[model samples]
Each structure stands twice: as structure tokens, then as C-alpha cells.
Target chain A: MLKVLKYSFYDLSRSRWTYAYLLFFLLLTFGLLNFSHDLSKTIISLMNVVLILTPLIGTLFGALYYYNSKEFIDLLLALPLPRRSIFLGKYLGLSLSLSASFVIGILAPMLLFGILSTGLVLNLVILMSTGVLLTFIFTAIAFLVSIRFEHPIRGFGAAIFIWLFLAVIYDGILLLILIWFEHYPLDHFALLMTLFNPVDLSRVLIMLQLDISALMGYTGAVFRKFLGTSLGMSIAYATLLTWIIVPVFAFLWLARRKDF
Target chain B: MIVRDLYKSYRKHQVLKGVSLGLDPGRITAVLGPNGSGKTTLIKCMLGMVIGQQGEISANGKNIGHDYLYRKDIGYLPQIARFPENLKVRELVSMVKDLRNQPANYEELVSRFGLGPFMQKPLRNLSGGTRQKVNILLAFMFDSRYYILDEPTAGLDPLSLQRFKEMLLNEKQKGKAVLMTTHMVHLAEEMADEVVFLLEGKVYFHGGVQELKDTYDGMNLEAAIANILSLQEHA
Candidate 1:
């Protein structure tokens, strides 16, 4: 398993795109955090970027990577290698890479801020963990999209459109609904929606810790009430872990059953 | 190696219709046919690359698809192979070795295929024939029990062809099953222990090359193939 992962990492490390993404996002994260004095404001500034763009870029890049490497995969498939190990190797390598980038881009700046103000260190750790989940959730979605679509462009377009709908359009429409139904507290409805989208849940949880989550709506309150408890936070992380493993496993099954 | 009544279709169009054949270990069995006559599909089915709708394909006493625990003992050279542009010869060999979970003697493969001087050069710089040679080396690397090659010598010089034939003979000597599909009937005539002539989606004739010549009013395989096609039309 370690060898497989090591090989996967070696393969990706050779790719110029991987290094470029890491460096580009690291610079971008630093720029965003330095946008303001108050960490919450700096965070909201970056949130606009992270919530909308991180998953979109991650999904598109990951999907494109898969599509472009079909010949390599065929060579591998012709060998005695098991399909499950291949999937795990790729998932672990990609997840580890994106998490490392997230740490550099988002977590590092926040961690430095948390150090100056000691109480928020745990809050910052929770927030970064949420980013890890968010990255994996999107990576899985992208993997499925890449396999399902015959054309790489089609897969990339579908991923971008999904990101647009989920991150931008869905939130916009939901806010409109919330404002109109001010008398009716849709706390449960928001929780269900957040659970469905790890990205949304991540955003809400981070904002709740910063106590500047008014725009995050009922979802923010639910995460604060539930995930504020240490056990609830652990359960939330566990659920995110499931989101990572399930789709990848499904992809393995699909690839195994597929007539290559 | 045995192939039991195999059936396959692509959506509404049937490609292989209840085809069955056997290949003896230590001998090359050439599958000869026109395009879209299920020659490629049959090979693909045996590799479990294409799903057979009915029946089973067994090599070394195990079914091809689900019971292919024996793939560790199989080598496949696909019709067309593409390599990464920037990868050197060593990188290419390394990639396959990692996938196979076996250590390959790079010197043996490189020297055998005349890839030593070209080792440092990227795959993009190599000729099409060199690329085909790379694919062949990868296929013959571990020397498993079964070899299924499609258009095995499409791009090769006389020397390379001789080397390839020698490799095929070596596999046969080791009692490894060799099934090949090729347009070069001359090579087929030279090497085939038995000839399976297919037309449309079914086998029109299955016998030795000499049998094909003697039974039909033809001198060699091309005429024999023409005779089979005409017979299929008459039938």
C-alpha cells in the first residue's frame, strides 16, 4: 500500500501542474489572509475565493488528470495490478497533495493568527480538517465525472457547471428563500443541505467559530450547536471520512465492472 | 487454451455470434479474417477487455474474465500502443515494472529490442516502429503462460520480424499458449500450428494451413481465405 502511494506521489510530483497549483494557491492564500487586520474579515475575504473556487479547481484538475492519463492507466491495467489498489493509490496521493496545499494556502496563515490569539487554535484546526473533507468530497465527485464522460472537456465543463450551481447559484437562491421565510426558521432544512455538501458544512463551521456567520444563515447555527461539542465534531469528521472512501470505492467497482 | 461458445454484441449489432475455438500450448494459432469479422473482438474478449455476452474463454485451465487469476501469467500486445511524450525508455519500463509488481531486466529488454542507444531519448523522439517494439518488449517481459497479440508485426523490419518470430517460437517451446491476429497471412502461414478463418461474425473454417490449401482450390492462405469468403457467400 505504501509503495503504491509512493509511486502515485512520484508520478504526480513529476507533473508541472501539481507544483504550479501548490505554489499558486499558497501565494493566493497568503494574499487573501493579509487582506485585512481582523482574521474573521480576512477569512470572509478568502471564503469568497475558497468556497467558490477551491472545489471547482480541485475537481477540474483531478478529472483532467485522470482523462489525460488514460494510456498510462491502460498500461497499468494490462499488468497484474488490482483495480482497488490503483484507485486507493491515486486517491491517497491526490488527497494528500490537495490537503498539503490547503495547509500551506489556508491553514498556515490562520494558524499564525491563532498563535497570536491562543483561544482560536482549536477552531483553526477544526476549520482545516473541514477543508480536507471538502477537498476529498470534491475529488470523489470529480473522479466519477471523469469516468462517466467520454470527453475530457465534457467532464471538465460538467465539473465547473456543478461548482457554479452548488457554490454560487444554490447559495444565492437559498438566501433568497431564507429572507422571504423570516418567520419560519428552516434550521433542519439547512442542516440537511450542509450534510449533503461537505463544502457548505465546512464554510458554515469555520464561520461559526469566528462568530461572523450571519450570512451563513441557519446552517451556521446548526454546526455551532452540534459541532461545537467535541464528540459532535469528531462525528462530523468521521462522516466526512465516509464521504472520501465511499465514492472512490464506488469508482473502483465501476472500473472493475467496466469493459475497458 | 480453450474458448467455449462465446457471444458478443455492440448495442444492436452483433460482432461475435457463438464463436468457439481452442489453442494448443507451444504453438501459434492465427486468427485470420477481414475487418469487423470479430477477430479483434474475440481477442479482446479473451483478455476480458470486452465483455462476452455468453460462454467462457479459458487460458491455462481458467476462465478469462472473472477467473483470470492467471493474468499474472499472461502477456498482451495491443493493436496500437501510445506512450507518454516526455518519458524516457527507462521511465517507460519502470512504469510497467511498477504495475506488474515484478523486477524486469531492463538490459535484456532494451538490448533485445535494440533500445539501448535510444534509452535516454524521450518516447516522442522515437519512430513508430520503435514504439511498437517497446510495446512488444513489455508484453514479452515477464514471459507468462499465454500471449495474445493483435497485429503483432504491423510495423517492423526484417530483423525485428525475425526476432519476433524467434520470441514466438521460444514461448511455444516453453508450452505457453500463443494466439495471434494478423493481416500478414505469410507470417501466419509460416508460424500457425492451426488457422481459424473467420468471415462476418462466425468461423468459416478451422484447420491447419495445409488443410486450408488442400481442401480449398488454392495454393496459399490468401487464396484459401478468398475461397472461404466465397463459400460463406454461397452458404
Candidate 2:
């Protein structure tokens, strides 16, 4: 398993695509911070760009990697290593690489932006968490998709469709749903939906923390109540963890059953 | 090994229909057939890489798909010779040995295959023939008991092909079971102990290579195959 993980990272490091992504994010944050010295401005800018972009790109790129590396995966399978170990090894490796980028990429910019204050610390923590959460969540999703789709283009198409639905269309549909249920008490239901969708929840939590939850529409306050308290935040964290785990186990199940 | 009434279909098109065959050690077998004749499918069934509709494949005194220990001693080189892009030749060789549950001098394997000159090169950077050489080396490096090499000499040069044949014969000397598929009749004519001719998802013939050659009078092995296939087609 350690061998698998080590080789997985080694393979990942060889790709100029991954290197480009890391540099793009790092430079984007660095340049954005220079544009604004205010800590909140920097945090929001980073959050908006990373939250909307990283998951889809990460999921697509990760899925692409899985498909393109079929030869390697088959080689791994040919060895005496258990399917679970190989699958988990690659998953852990991908997580670490993306997580390192998320942490270090944002940290460098935060330090240079003169972030030596309490608010800066909070903003940095929040920003870093969002990046890792995005990476892990999409990695889980990507792993499952990659195992399921044998064709690389098809997997990419499916990933984009899924990202579009989760990131955009789902929100529109939920808005109409909330409007239809305006006469009834749907705050709990609204909170449940937010928990189910981590992307919306992450953005909503950050907005509420910045004391601007009202702009998130009526569903924001309901989510704030469920995600604002210490316990609420912990529950939100657990939900994010579930987002990462559900797909992880699903991918493992598929990997084990996959003929490759 | 035993495959009892095996069946496999891709969506609505049935590729394998109630095919059954038995295999044993110390014999070199050839799955000879044209394209889409289900020869590869049969190999996949034996490896449990493809799930059949209704069948049980057993190998080495244990039921196939249920006994992984049987596979622990098997070395498989897939139909296509592919490796992880950007992997050094030595790294790929080392990875296979590691998976085979042992460690060996990977550089030795590389040097033996004349891959030392390209040792640090990436897989994608290598030529098709070189990649095929790498695949062959990895399959035979660990000294497996059961070897399934698909089109093993597809891109090999004459000298390398001769070396590979010698290597296969060495495995035969160890009493290992080798099931190889090939389009080159000459290699099969030279290396195989048994010829299992596959046609339209079924085993039309399974016997020693001499038995196949001597089946039809006054015809060479290739001519005999053409005659037998034409007869099958007409029948």
C-alpha cells in the first residue's frame, strides 16, 4: 500500500497538468491579494474563485487521470496487492497532493498580504478548509466516476454535467421549491438540502460568518441557524466528511469489482 | 481448470454462448481465431475479468473467481502493451515484482532486455516495440506458474521474438501452464504444445499441436487451418 501511494504521487508529479493547476491557483491568489490589502476582500476573492472552479476542475482532472492511467492501474492489479489497497492508496495520494496545494497555495499569499491579525487567521483557516474540502469531495466523486466510465471523454462529459447540476441548476430548482413552499415551514427542509450540498453550504457558512447571510436569500437564515453555532459548525464539518466518505467507499466498491 | 457452460454477452450481442473448456499444467495452449471470435473473451472468463451469465470456472483445485490464491501465481500481459505514462522502464519493472509479492534486481531485468539505454525514459517516450519488450519482460520476470500473454510478439523484432520463444520454452521446462494467443501462425506452430482453436465464441478444437497438424492429410498446419475453418463455415 505504501508502495502504491508512493508511486501514485510520483505519477501525479510527472503530469504538467497538475503542476499548472497548483501554480495557477497560487498565482491567482497572490495577484488577487495584491489587488486588495483588506483581509476579507482577499478571503472572499479566494473563496469565490476556488469554490466555484476547483471542484469541477479537480473532479474532471482527477477523473481524467484515472482513465488515462488505466495501464498503470492494471499493472497495480497484476501485482499481489489487494484491490482496496491500490484504490485507497491512489485516493490518499491524490488527496495529499491537492491538499498540500490548497494549504500552501493560500498560505503563501496570506502571509505576504500582511495577514498578521486575528481576522486574518480566521479567514486563512476558513479559506484553507474550503480548498481541502473541495478537493476531497470532488476526488471522491471523481474516483467513482472514473471507475464507472471506461471512456475518458464520456467520464469527462458526465463529470461536467454533474458539476453543472450540483453547482448551478440545483440552486435554481431549490429556489422555485422554496417559493412553492412559502406558506409552509420549510426551514428544516432547507437546512437539510444545504447539508446535502456542501458547495452551497460552504459558501453560505462563509457569508453568514462575514455577517451578510441576508444576501443569500431566505434559505440563508435557516442554514445559518443550522450551521452557525459551534455544534452546527461541527455538524457541517461532519457533512463535509460524509461528502468525502460516501464517494470514497463507493469508488472502493467499484474498484474492487472492476475487471481491470 | 474447468469452465462449465460459460456464457457472456455485451448488452444484447452474445459473445460467448455456453462455452466449456478444461485446462491443466505443463502444457502450452494457443487460442487461435480471427478477430471477434471470442478468443479474448474466453481468456477473460478464465481470468475472471469478465463475469459470465451462468458458469463456474475452477482452477488449480479451487473454484475460479472465488480463489485468489490461484491468481497469486499467475502473470498476465494484457492484449495491449501499456504502462503508466512517464514511468521509467525500471520503475514499471520494479512495480510488477512488488505486486508479485517479491523484490528483484529491476535494473538486471532492464539490462537483460537491453532497456538500460532507455532506463530513465518515460513510457510514453518509448517506441511501440520497446513498450512491448517491457511488457514481455515484466510478465516473465517473476517466474509465474500460470502465464497468460496476449499477442506476446505483436511488435517484437526477430531476435527478441526468438529470445521470447526460448523464455516460453524455459517456462515449459518448469512445467508452468502458458495460455498464449497469437495471430502469427509460425509462432504458434513453433512454440505451442496444444492448439485450442476458437471460432465464434466456442472451442472448435483443443489438442496437441501435432494432433492438429496431423488432422488433415497432405496439408501444412496453415493450409490445414484454412481447410478446417472453411469446412466449419460451410457446415
Candidate 3:
């Protein structure tokens, strides 16, 4: 498995798109820092971009990587390696590479501006960890979708729809539900809904840390009132970890029964 | 290797039904069939690439059911020579060697196939024949007990094809089991000690090459196969 991971990492490192993704972050961070001297405002801005873009890239890249490496996978299937190793190795390799890009891209510019001395360092850490967690979660979902659907376009379509559902549409539906049930005491309901979508949970998490009560919305407030700040943050992080783990195990199971 | 009572299907279409055969060492057995006749499915079943609905595929008297370690003793060349496009020939070779953790006689095979020039070239940049050469090189690199090749002669120039045939013969001389599928009847006639003809997911014929030729028309293997299909058509 480690050997597979090493080679997969090597292969992805050489791809031009990996560098392009890294460079995009580098430029975005630098541009955001240059435009705004306030570090808190910059972290919030980066958070918005990170929440949306990381899942998108993770979905597209995960599906595309599976479709592209299919032939190579056939080669691997004929070897002595187990299916678990081939698939889990690929998932970890992809997540690590994308996480590395996000981390390096975001950290380099912040370090250049000397963020270590500021109290905003903790906020930056939360933002970066959420980005990494989101990358792992969505990449795992993409792998599960791709492995299930043999057609590349179908796989890609399903994967993107999942990201869309989790990152955007789910929240929209939750909003409609909240408005419809506004008269009732819906605190627990809203908090449970937030836990269902990693994207929203991450947004609430970062907003709570930044002490931006306005953007935290009703669910984030419920999160704070019921669980307090530290406990709420811990629960959110644990749920995000669950998000990453469930899909990975699901895909590995599917890979074993797969025909290819 | 022995395959007994093999059955496979894709959705509503059954590809292999009650197909069975035995492959012997020290000889080359050719799996010949028309398109969509489940020839590839049978080979894939043995390699455990495609799972069979109901069957038993055993290598060295042990059932190869969800067990991958047995594959180390088998070398396989898939029908398509597609690979990770970004990987250079050398890297791909080494990657396979690393994954299997087996010593490979790759240098000799690379030189024999004249692939030395393309060692540093990415797989996407290589010509179809060059890719096929790489496929063959990988299949024959390790000293495995069995060889399963699908369309092994595709896109090969005459010299390279001759070299590949020589390699197969050498492997056979070392008492390795070889199961290959091909459309080229002449190649099958010249190389296969026994031929297994598949039609509509069944082994219609399994016997010595000369016996197959003699049973149909006392002519070449191609005409013999043509006669069998025509007879099935009339029936």
C-alpha cells in the first residue's frame, strides 16, 4: 500500500494541473493579503474561497484521476497487490497532494506577511485544517462514486452532483425548511442539519472561531448555546473526521466487489 | 490451471455459460473465437479481473477466489496496452517490479524488443506498436509459472512478432503454461499445441491443432474454423 502511495504521489506530483492548483492558491492568498492589511478579514475571505473551491477541486480531480488511471488500475489488479491497497493508497495519495497544495499555497503567503506573531494564528489553523478535512471528505466521496459508475461521464456527473448537494443545495433546502418551521423551537433540528453537511459545519466552525456571530446564523448560535464554543468545535471536527472516514471505507468495500 | 463449470454474465447478457477447460504446462494453448464470444471474459476470470458468477479457477490446484497472491505466479498481458500516460517506460517497468516485489529480466526483454530508445519516453508519446512491445515486455519480464496474453500479436512488426514468438517458445520450453487469445489463425496454427474455440459462451472445440484441422476440412486451421461456423449457421 505504501509503495502504491509513493508511486501515485510521484505520478501526481509531475502533473501540470497539481502545480497549477498550488499556484492558484499562492496567487489568491498573496492577492488577498495585498489588498487587505487586516489579517482577520483576510482569513475570513480565504475561508469562503476554501469552503467552496476545495470540495470542487477534490470532486473533479478525484473522478478524473480514477478515470485516467483506470488502465493502470487494470495492470495493478493483475499483480499480487490487494484491492484494498490499490484503492486506499490512491485515496490517501490524492488527498495528501491536494491538502499539501492548499496548505503550502495558503501558508507561504501568510508566513511571508508574518502571521505567527498575531493572535489570528489559531483562526488560520482552524481555516487550514477545515480545508484539509474538506479535501479528504470530498475526494473520498468522489472515489466511491467513480468506482460505482463505470462510465466516466456518469461517474463525473454523480460526483459533482454530490458535491453540489453537500456544498450548496443541502444548505438551501435546510434554509427552506427553517423558514417553513420558524414558529417552532427548532434548535436541535437546525444543529443536526448542520452536522449533515460538512461544508455548512465547516462554515459554522470557522465563524464561531472568528467570533462572527452574524455569519454564524441560527445553526451556529444553536451550536454555541447548546454545546458551548470548545465542545461545539470538537464535535464539528469529529463529524468532519467521520465525513472523511465513512466514504473512504465505503469506497474500499465497493472496490473489493468491483469488476475492474 | 483448471477451469470448471464457469459462468459469467454482464447484465442480461450471459458471456460465459458452463465453460470449462484445462491448460497444461510445456505447451501453448490458444483461445480462439469470434467477437463477443466470451474469450476475454474467460481469461479475465482466470486473472480474477472479472468475477465469474459461478465457477472455479484454480492455479496449481488451489482455487483463485478473491485471493491475489496467486497472481504473482501468473503473467498477464491485457488486450489494450493503455497505461498511465504521464509515466515513462522505465518508471512503469520499475513500478510493476516494485509492486510485485519480483526480480525481472527486463533489460534483456527491452533490448530484444528494441525498446531501449523509448525508455525515457512517456507512454502517451509511444506509438501503438511500441506500447504493445512494452505490454509484452512486462508480461514476459518475470519468470512466472503461467502466461495469459490477450491479443498478444496486435500491432507488432514482423521482426518483433518473431521475437515475441521465440520468447513464448522459450517460456514453453521451461514448462510454463501459456493461454493466449488471437484472431490470427495462422499464428494459432503455428504456435498453439492445443486450441480452444469458443462460440456463444461455450467451448465448441478443444483439441490438438492438427486434430481441429483434420476434423473439419483436412485443410488449414482458418478454413477449418470457417467450416465450423458455417456448419453452426446451417444447423
Best by DockQ: 3
How does candidate 3 fare on TM-score? Answer: 0.97
Which candidate leads the pack in TM-score? 3
Question: Clashing residue pairs in candidate 1, if any?
Answer: none
Clashing pairs for model 2 are A79-B99, A80-B99
Those runs of model 2 whose alpha carbons end farther than 4 Å from true positions after fitting are A113-119, A180-185, A214-221, B1-4, B66-69, B105-113
TM-score of each: 0.91, 0.90, 0.97
Q: Across residues B133-200, which tens digit of lDDT does each residue of candidate 1 receive?
A: 88888888875878889898988988988988987887799998888999888999999999887777
Q: Model 2 over residues A1-260: C-alpha lDDT tens digits?
A: 78888888877776776677778878988888777767777777777887788787768877877877677777766566677878889888887787776677778777877787545677677767877888888877888887898888888888777778878888898889989988998888888887778788777767767777887666677777677789999988888899988999998988766655
What does candidate 1's lDDT look like per residue over A1-260, in tens digits? 45557766776778777777677666766676666556655655666566656687668767877787677666666666666666667767776777677767666666666645656565556556666667777788788777777788898888777777777787787778877986897877766666666666677667766777666555566767777788766766676777777878778777776666
Docking class of 2: acceptable
lDDT of 2: 0.77
Better of 1 and 3 by DockQ: 3
Q: Write the residue-wise lDDT of candidate 3 on A1-260 in tens digits.
A: 99889988888999898999999999999999999977888999998999999999999999999988887788889999889999888888999999999999999999999899899999999999999999999999999999999899999999999999998899899889988999998879988888889998888888777888566577556777754656766788899999999999999988888776
Clashing pairs in 3: none
- DockQ for every model, please: 0.53, 0.44, 0.80
TM-score of predicted structure 1, chain A: 0.84
Residue A93 CA error for candidate 3 (Å)? 1.2
User: What is the DockQ score, from 0 to 1, of model 2?
Assistant: 0.44
For residues B1-235, write the lDDT of model 2, one tens digit per residue: 6678888888788888777766567878877887898877877777766667778888776776633556677777778877877778767666666656664544555655677788778788988888888887777776677888789898888887787888788778888889888988777888888887878877778787788877786466788788877887899
Q: After superposition, how far is residue A31 of candidate 3 from its true place, in Å?
A: 1.6
What is the Cα-based lDDT of residue A185 in candidate 3?
86
Would you list the rank order by TM-score, best first? 3, 1, 2
